[model samples]
Target chain A: MAFDLTLLTGSGFWNPFFWLISIVVALILIYIIYAFGEKGYKRGTQQVKPFISGNPEPSKAGVHVRAGNLYWGYMDALKVYYAGLVPIHSGILTDYLLWLFSVAAILFVLVVLL
Target chain B: MITDFLLHHTPALLVAVPLLGAFLTPIIGRISPIVRKIWVMGTMTLTSAIAVLLVYLVYTRGTFVYVFGALTPGLAIPPDSGGIPIRIIFTVDPMGAFMDLIVAVVGFCVILYSLSGDEKRTGLHYFYTLFLLLITSVLGMVSTGDLFNFFVFIEISSLASAGLVAFSVEQGRAVEAGLKYFMISTMGGIFLLFAIGILYGQYNALNIAMIAERMQFTSLDKIALVLMVVALAMKCGAVPLHFWTPDAYSLAPSTITAMLVVVSQASLYGLFRFVFTLYNLTLNYVTIGWVIIILGVLSMVIGVTMAIPQKDVKRLMAYHAVSQTGYMLLGVGVGLAVLGNQAALDTYGFIAIEGGLFHIINHALYKGLLFLTAGAIIYRIGTRDLNKMGGLGHSMKYTMIFFMIGALAIAGIPPFNGFASKLLIYESVYLFNPLLAIIAMVVSILTLASFVKVFHSIFMGPTLPEYSKVREAPPAMLIGMGILAVLIIAFGFFPQLVVDSLVAPAAHALINQGSYISAILGGA
Candidate 1:
């Protein structure tokens, strides 16, 4: 039987054949593009070398970006939120247990009062 | 006849077979490492097959109770006793079968991955033994109908997982992580035991269905509910209480980390069982539901934000595990919020729960794949520092593809399992509250952004001189990851199949508690 999920709503997402056809069509289209595009490609030449703003390529190690520096702006903008969150994940067992207890206490109050 | 026996005794055997394998693993290992490896594989294969059979039996035969050491499965309550199940009971409802399927599938894959990934490690027998025992405990936790039995299983799982976490003695950090995990797990265990004790003291019964039938929702029951939910939320790595999750997940051997993800999901299963079945409609669900929802929102926001800044690849994935867990909580929490109101529940609650439940399986598959891939990178290059990993795509083509599949799946990209479930959550939760759904969408975007950073840092850059000699991961690891990747794609494309076969029956069994109680009481 098909998976209906009618209890959740009238929505159902069960057309495997549709997905199969779509994937086949997409792959064929991509294969056609690649087959046509390969005629202009050159191999084993200076033209194949990576260009960095028309400057000579630096050592790979020097140019490789590290994970720590990848999202500097995002971190800077969320500085205050991180300051609050990062400290709370303090890697201390005592603090972790404390948080567990605090949440329990808060939940207790809420469940009882409401 | 044999099939009948196995079907009748599936629940007990599911737990017992693994426990037996665990005890025999070290003895078998002493004979020969190869023999031990074969034995472990055989054991897990059998266990997984039995789990599948149990799910089939549950779906076809309906809910049933298996009383340990009893004359008959139906003899849960002693004739002398006042309708209380004195013996330990194993309730193989659809929900339990659902969790068993997850534990079995993931546990089998982890064992396959571990065969090669941890081949050279010392005390290999102990590792395999603890792994089997951990699986046993998880199965027990999901299947047991007795609250005290659940507590016992929780303790076993905690100890076994902690041992596995500390397996790499060379890494002092692994030992530290194990210690922290043990301490927090112990605290959670104590709270769990205390809550069980409260219920036992008040109702004089330890069986979940029994106590649920007699639920008074008294002051003590409220306290017990708080303690139980808090402890389980902590165990499952819910936010505000999820500090130990990253440390333990990052430090464990990659295969064990994959299994630990399932371990946490078992805890999540327990949380849902307590909320939906044990408490049912007796408690102030709206209040409890909002509390859970708030915890989920916190976990989602904090987990992804923290993951974005992490330099350690495994640690980043661990935080994402926490974030993915939040989606399950949010989906189920929405269901709980509208529990008693039939109109609201019929309108959106069931879908919300389905979304959460669907996410559970999807998360397990994709997260397990991600950890295995991370392990592969570490196995080849000897480091999890993303900065050090560059141009691995050149050497490890299959690994790159697997990682991409996992990355896209976890990021909720379409044509992946994560997207299917997240769609259900978004569309349904939006009806409940627009703001919640919007936050969920924002979290999904951030998850994608964080993983993009991971992908670019690890695979997209120029080939580094340091990793020039690094080769592809071994075939066994690839096969393990391949299984999960294939399943992820299949589930993504055919979500309706998964929903019909697994999620719907499981969600219905969970939300319908009367059937659970009646299975034991014989419709009394």
Candidate 2:
């Protein structure tokens, strides 16, 4: 019943106990770091003021980013790719069927040829 | 003695109990809504118990064939038949039992969640009935040994799920989604039937084992294989043919959406069954395997990319579901590619296949939990739009915690169930080809990034003035999420226990197709 997949060289990921021990050791290290950190900070004071290159702080609602605006750079870089791919998911029934038929045809040809 | 009786009749009872409950739901609803709720929960609990027992029986006793209407379960083929199985048989192998276990556990949790989550909707009786029937169809699809029976169950599940998808008629988009789902499923069903006809014409058999035993691997068989694989992959939401997935998944009622995830996994189970058991290594393993691998890669990349720009929470999660499916396909595809090479298989191929099998269960648990959490949020907030919500963590603390758990689990963070299986795939698949493993790791990072976006938009930031009065989801919904949450933690911590008892055995059953064919034809 012991399911162990021994990888190359005798090391493997079969023992959950190893993971448990690692987790405990990591937690202890984190606790030690937290204990050594600065404390006695006060909220709602100039000391805790927001810093943004010395610019005035914006309203909370305005600063909260929306999901659509979060990944702008990634989307912009992949613009051409999205232009080709997004239209395929055009939410049309005919396009869906067309894709199914096209994939079937391609797979059939590949299987037969190979 | 009672265990013997139940074990003997497990296959029939697995399908029958839900079917009977489905029919009786409307009648019981007239008596009292409370009675109806109790009835649905009681039925699913009973069915879940039976599924566990069936998996136990299959794992302990090996593969057994239960022939319908026969005096004994072992009489799969007629004595006078010329080595052909004429009777419809229910083949309970380890793989089938594993799928049954998934359907049972997820289906039961969904039913429990719906009790409170859907309490205010009209036509409660019909909803419960279709839900039960959906469960029955999924169970039938996985357990049946006959190809034609599998088709019948596929149709039933398709219709039931489409009906549930359209349940929210108030949203015109739901109706549109249901229509698209029905049309796609109808096309899939037709192709499935045509493939079955081709096999029946060539081998004169509808039983999967019979056709597999007599397979000639002719040109016609090649055509059938293409048709079957494409149709099942389309049904399971593989990219290029997965347009129906996001629409159907996003539009369905949340509980039903959870069930739809399981439905897609069932179709995936069918795809693997056909490839590994029916075709075995007879076909061009490298070509077909690469085809699957390429499909997996596209799904993984495109699924995550599409999810990034989505504003609707459910639609975003739907896309992630597709991406997660790619991992399963990738792991198993690598296994298939090296199927005929015993040296490669012994070294890393079986591990890859186990990784895929392990991901199947993990995906079902985490994805199902995520959907239920989305439902709980929508129940309180009245909107699935991410931009309109913030700071739900203040009022709905438990829901926030559950969502965090599901989010972490789905993103493949360590110590969760997703990480264990994914780690197996990433390590072992590098041996096959480093690029595939690299792409998989990149997809994992993207998945985590997307979920972080979701967590920040919905649960972080200042509390929205509109949702200040929003309360936590009801106890029943919390209970449903709790079941999956506890399981996620258990499977995460005890990965070896699950791999040993379930995934490894299931992977072995899939690779060893000789035993499957011999079990049916050995007696004859």
Candidate 3:
């Protein structure tokens, strides 16, 4: 009884057993809702195809977005941010060492003084 | 009787057996490649068993030391008898034993995964040799009580890992990545050696316990501390010092990439061992702790943000590895920050560090599984570009499930091991400072978003025409992945069991510096 398997995060406890059970119940509920609708829907047809601004995608490939295109807007939003962050990962060994030694230099002063 | 002998000699055997097996691999390969594979697997099984038994002993019997060779590292030397004690000590507290378990599990699984690589490659004999040696080095690193030997193990691991990273030499970039990893590691190793020399000059001792026993925390000591911190921080892929990580991890054989995750944690082990065990109360805890937290926060934010837009699956995972490493740093770093105030320490400090430590093991399993699944895809479909991968879930169902388990877990999703640790970290670090906790949570969200992109890009969508005939990963590879997958789920379902049984005791051992010192110096 002492070490019952419930993780006590400082503020609360997480019992995965309860979480798992709730998940199963929620899943059952989802299945029931799903079962009620979409019974007439068919697979491998235009029913599954994407509706674009006006027309259906021409082919399956047109609908399947490539991974390189997945995070376009996210990258767009973070252009300035990545500009600053990505350049530091210039893949140059010198710059890498510069970061390493630069950190060592700063910490050298801080550790000594503080 | 054999158990008794093993109990006494586990530390030495843990390092030595694999080292010997590594040297024997090429010779065994001469006999037959199959024979060499058997020999390497046999050696690892025995080593993993030794690790498990070591963990059991350390857990039940409390912390202990194993000494080998003639002269101790400037400790308890009979003054008149003369020779400098060149001895090595392996001290296995709960923490060391915890690290041993991590390497053991990851090492065994990676060896299994490497068999798939071995079938396609020619220099597999050399591959197994370096692999075993890397395992030996990490095991020795975690278990060693002496600083010099720890450095020795670090050097050996870096060399072996550099070789493995360049194993696919046909690709020019693998060579490039290996060179980068090698040079960075060499520089970090040099800094570490200089720091060790400084300590040796100041204290005349190479044993961690011996130095901790007599730490003066002078200015010279601070210089040495910064050097060691930077070196180990670089080794573990802390943000600014983490440039080598994505390159090395992305380019390494997937098996080696997985093992590299554990290897970085060994450095994390070294970093924690230094701060908590060596410089616990003698130094300015708050300043150093805050320093670690900042590094962690940067790693979390920068690493994840870089990950989101990456098209390369492994490189993307590599960035996330950098991000995940931040959580460990944040969690334990919080614990370190709170060390000055006994009330704060008692209130949430231990929980925070435990969160960090727990994350280490969790990260190893899921991250390793993710890498292996990436390898499996590369094996069948022959590309690491997530854009090129699709419908893999239809063909490679097991790998897909493993990837899901790993992805969900890494995202800190519930009913998984990552969530448990993240929750612990979130709640505890919130007590220390709310902003850091919020940053950690935001990082987790980004992590989930990035992994979602990965899942959609790589495994979702229709089975592309080119990959329609792609078979599942081989039995050995699936078994390798299955081991981690099972553990991930088991750990998820029973996070508390793992924490109570494995994590809390390790945290206790880490913070109780007096015990570590006394265990080594015989109550000085």
* Per-model chain A TM: 0.68, 0.64, 0.73
Residue B428 of model 3: what lDDT? Answer: 97
Which 10 consecutive residues of model 1 chain B have the lowest summed lDDT? Answer: B515-524
- lDDT of model 1, residue B172: 99
Q: List model 1 lDDT by residue over B1-524, tens digit each.
A: 99788977888889889999999998989998889999999999999999988888888888768999888876888787777789999998989989999999998888998899999899998999999999999999999999999999999999999999999999999999999999999999999999999999999999989899999999999999999999899989999889999999999999999999999999999999998899989999998888888888988988999899999999999999999999999999999999998998888888889999999999999999999999999999999988778888888889999999999999998678898899888888889999999999999999999999999888877789988898899999999999999999888877877887889899999999898988887645
Chain B TM-scores across candidates: 0.99, 0.99, 0.97
Model 1 residue runs over 4 Å out of place are A3-40, A51-55
Score residue A95 of candidate 2 by CA lDDT: 91
Model 1: which residue pairs collide?
Answer: none
**What TM-score does prediction 2 earn?**
0.95
Q: B387-413, model 3: which lDDT tens digit per residue?
A: 777777889888889999999999999
Cα deviation at B464, candidate 2, in Å, is: 1.3
Fnat of candidates, each listed: 0.61, 0.50, 0.78
Candidate that scores best on DockQ: 3
Instruction: DockQ for every model, please.
Output: 0.52, 0.43, 0.69
Please give the TM-score of chain B in predicted model 1: 0.99
Give lDDT for model 2: 0.90
Q: What's the lDDT for all of these models? A: 0.90, 0.90, 0.90
Docking class of 1: medium
Quality of candidate 2's docking, in CAPRI categories?
Answer: acceptable
